[model samples]
Target: DPKVDVLGLPDWVKFIFLDIGLASIVFTCILGQLTTQVNASHMMIDFINNYFAVFTLYTAMTIEFIGIMHCAYLIKNILSAVSGKPILSNEPPKTGFTFAFYWVRVLMSCAILSFCVAVVFTALLAGDTAVSVKYPSISPPLAVVLLLFFMGVVGTLEAMQIAFFSVAKLPPSQRGTNWFGSKTCSLLFDGNGKNLPTFMIGRQLTVVCSFFLVGSFTSLTIVPGTGNNIFGVSDTSQAFLNYGFQGAVMTTILASIMWQYAASAFPVTFLNSLISFILLIVALCLEGTGICGACWV
Candidate 1:
């Protein structure tokens, strides 16, 4: 009885239960969206069908990503502690740096999940890449570039999110009293008064890259979309709407990943980023090859 916590559940058992319950609820709603048909003509149904569905799918994917990443990190930390690893070793883990990856992981996850939803919708509603297009086709080089661009866009956004979070996480007492000095320094670095800046240079570069990306056509939305355009002025608007939902999902994922990996090492961050990068690359290749199948436009 003394060993058991509230509700007679061990801490680990409670965590497992929590994970399972959360995952089940998210997936069940996703299933509902996939199965239940709604009229596109009615206002509510139209919004649900066109807007809400995409939002729900991406949100679910983001939640799944965060949960999975957190569990993996928690397990690693438990193993390390059980193995009698020293926490305050000379090469101490830069937790702040690793935590920054929380933002990166969430953004990347959303990009991936949203991309999948787009493909699935295309396949079900229209046709896929089974048919060859002769008039205007994407060259292999161009396709690779497009895929890289997508990753870059996501990466830049990730960098910005990290910057914002890092600054926000700083204690008020740690911040500079002068507005001009605080604003100027905050624009460059991401850290409290204690540790050196983490990802400051990276953030600066990313902010510039993201600026160019925002101005360019490399984003999810395009001026003239190829869908029925019934959801909004164009299908691109719906894509943007899905993106908005993914932003909320990203916020939750960032918090979850950081809390779970609070005691984790740099290796955890590296491995997560590597996996996310690889997945994006594979997905891009699939897109290029037409193996994953394209949506009917």
Candidate 2:
């Protein structure tokens, strides 16, 4: 049976209208900032400088969206467990709304993948000079390597979505025959709990890595006093730290409240907040000490 919320609206409606709409708004705001900066400066240096900052912001936004989705899924599982109601079964789309929603998700995934590829190509064509000059601490080769790693992280996240959708689109018999299809099914359902622990561990690790990677870059390149930017005295590090920590704390508090209402248990919500704090500290340390091989001098 298809999932419907209390208001009788299908799950697809919420996912399409709410989740995608929010992501689009976030992207548009960031993109607008980049566009404004670019339009204000005709020099190549200024353009490249703004590009790096915008790119880092984009990466952080992507991480935030992914984290929110994963957290929502976790809460859904918790609700299902507490209520002793099985999750809605995964079946091929039948209704027009469901079919349109499925295709929209697929197309968005493809668009993201294409955008990632384009960015990678642009970075490569921009060459070592652009990267090295913008991030003067690291050697050109190492800077390029780091940029590629950032791109890879974003690409991999979206690629996983596309892979899952692809697998879901296949016939049940055909899904088992395909490696990604079979693995996706196992990871998605994880009825035996065999992969859930590993999945959560890996996801948390990715979140930490992404936070540090993007944070370190933005700290040096986008932080107003630190970098050669027109935006005066803006501290990207502090801003990111505030955003990350606040987001985690708020999400945890909300989730805990929901859990309390549903299960009548006041569970601790400090884990995610603590993780966010620690990750920010580590990133700040790396940024301050230049221990991550990025000396701004």
Candidate 3:
């Protein structure tokens, strides 16, 4: 029957999600070849000094988006409970003026803000004399600290989302999910006893994000450049990996939420979000293929 469990999920959901994740990974891998050469100023100190900070900010933004998405998914059930809510069945992406839509729009805005930080890198911070003085052309290493900050943001975002979701949605019977780790009395136990919140998605999202991080660094090394352009990632294989990182991370989170939540956001919001997620995931997959090709040679 349709209700059969595949990897602890309904078969239909498992299939759809796997499709989304797989397609994305494959498509992104293809973009890798076009971007890996680094010919113009590939690995140049000036380029790295100029671009690394911005790139780090971008990466952090991307990661933060993923983290927030993760939190939302984790907490979907709990949030519904807070409202004394009930589950809704699966349906296509919809559009409407629902409470869910209002919340999701706000969430998406915050999620997208991470990459928006790149706006600073694109101009304001790029050649800013003030930033240059503070960061210093000679102090490229300081960018590492900036990079750390981005990672911390990602981590904090993830932690915050996880805690909120766990407490709010998860049952007290599911004690293991508690802040101190699962204990004897998680709130999620049924009469027969079972963990209500299945958490495999967290592990899956982590795997997908790890792949993007690897692909990004690897792609950076091999990614060719075109005339000292700041937007090299846009046209090349690196973009696939970079954006794929965005995609895989984003989509995985989305997939989890889709699997767990009630789809109240009407068609436009849902469709747009889905498309954005798919595009990135495919780019990552293609990025991986390119990485493999390089290894074989």
Q: Cα miss at 86, model 1 (Å)?
A: 14
Ranking by TM-score: 2, 1, 3
- lDDT of all the models against the reference? 0.39, 0.40, 0.38
TM-score for all predictions? 0.25, 0.28, 0.22
Expressed as tens digits, the lDDT of each residue in 193-262 for candidate 3 is: 4222212122223334444332222112223354433344454644444333443343334333433343
Q: What does the lDDT read for residue 154 in candidate 1?
A: 45
lDDT of 1 at 241: 44
Q: How far does residue 218 in candidate 1 sit from its true spot (Å)?
A: 5.6
State, as a TM-score between 0 and 1, how close model 3 is to the true structure. 0.22
Better candidate number, 1 or 2, judged by TM-score: 2
List where candidate 3 sits over 4 angstroms from the true fold: 1-90, 93-131, 177-179, 182-297
Number of the predicted model whose TM-score against the real structure is largest: 2
**Candidate 1 C-alpha error for residue 207, in Å:** 4.5
lDDT of 1 by residue, 46-131 (tens): 56666667998899788666643343344345546764554555854647866677556645555654544454234223322211
RMSD score of candidate 2 (Å): 23.4
Model 2 TM-score, 2 decimals: 0.28
Of candidate 3, the 10-residue stretch with the lowest lDDT total is 194-203
